[model samples]
Target: MYPLNLPPAQILQLSSQLLCSGLALLLVGLAAAYGLEKQLNVPTLVLAHSLTLIGPSVLKIGYVLRLVAQQRLKDETCAHAIA
Candidate 1:
């Protein structure tokens, strides 16, 4: 668990790290798509485009999952507070 006293600078740094990691994953997925198209004898152009299309959806799903987890945590906190 993260310390509750985390400073704004530390938060910003963590945000930057997450953004960079996400970008790296996106690039790796693209590269994998390219390789799959070439090695699997599929249509490279179409698969690359599909990768672009699917990448955002994958990221959004991750965002949704994070939101759900956060929401659940918040609810638990509130429940504890009330009790």
Candidate 2:
């Protein structure tokens, strides 16, 4: 929501990369969480791990949608520039 005023192309590129990174991190975190839950069986660790996994998943989905929007904006920009 903060306006960095980056061009749509940059936003799309950066957000796409960030989205991928976020997903990779989410997978790793989930794996760790699974291990901790199964091996340690601690309730506090379970809650913390769940929150960590969930927050990033939300952020990753947001970035994916942001990238899509930025790509659409870039396409429209190109169209207008051409016409």
lDDT of each: 0.58, 0.68
Candidate 1 residue lDDT tens string, 1-81: 433344434444554555455565577667767655556544655656566666666566555445545555676689999
Report RMSD (Å) for each prediction in the order shown.
8.2, 4.0
Task: Show pairs that collide, candidate 2.
Answer: none
lDDT against true structure, model 2: 0.68
Least accurate 10 contiguous residues by lDDT in model 2: 1-10
Tens-digit per-residue lDDT, 1-83, candidate 2 = 53446666776667776677776666766766765666655775666476567658766765866866676797788999999
How do all models score by TM-score? 0.53, 0.53
Candidate 1: residue 59 Cα off by (Å): 0.4
Question: Once model 2 is optimally superposed onto the true structure by TM-score, how far is the C-alpha of residue 45 displaced, in angstroms?
Answer: 5.4
Q: What TM-score number comes out for model 1?
A: 0.53
Off by over 4 Å in 2: 36-51, 54-58, 61-83
Task: Give the CA lDDT, 0 to 100, for residue 63 in model 1.
Answer: 55
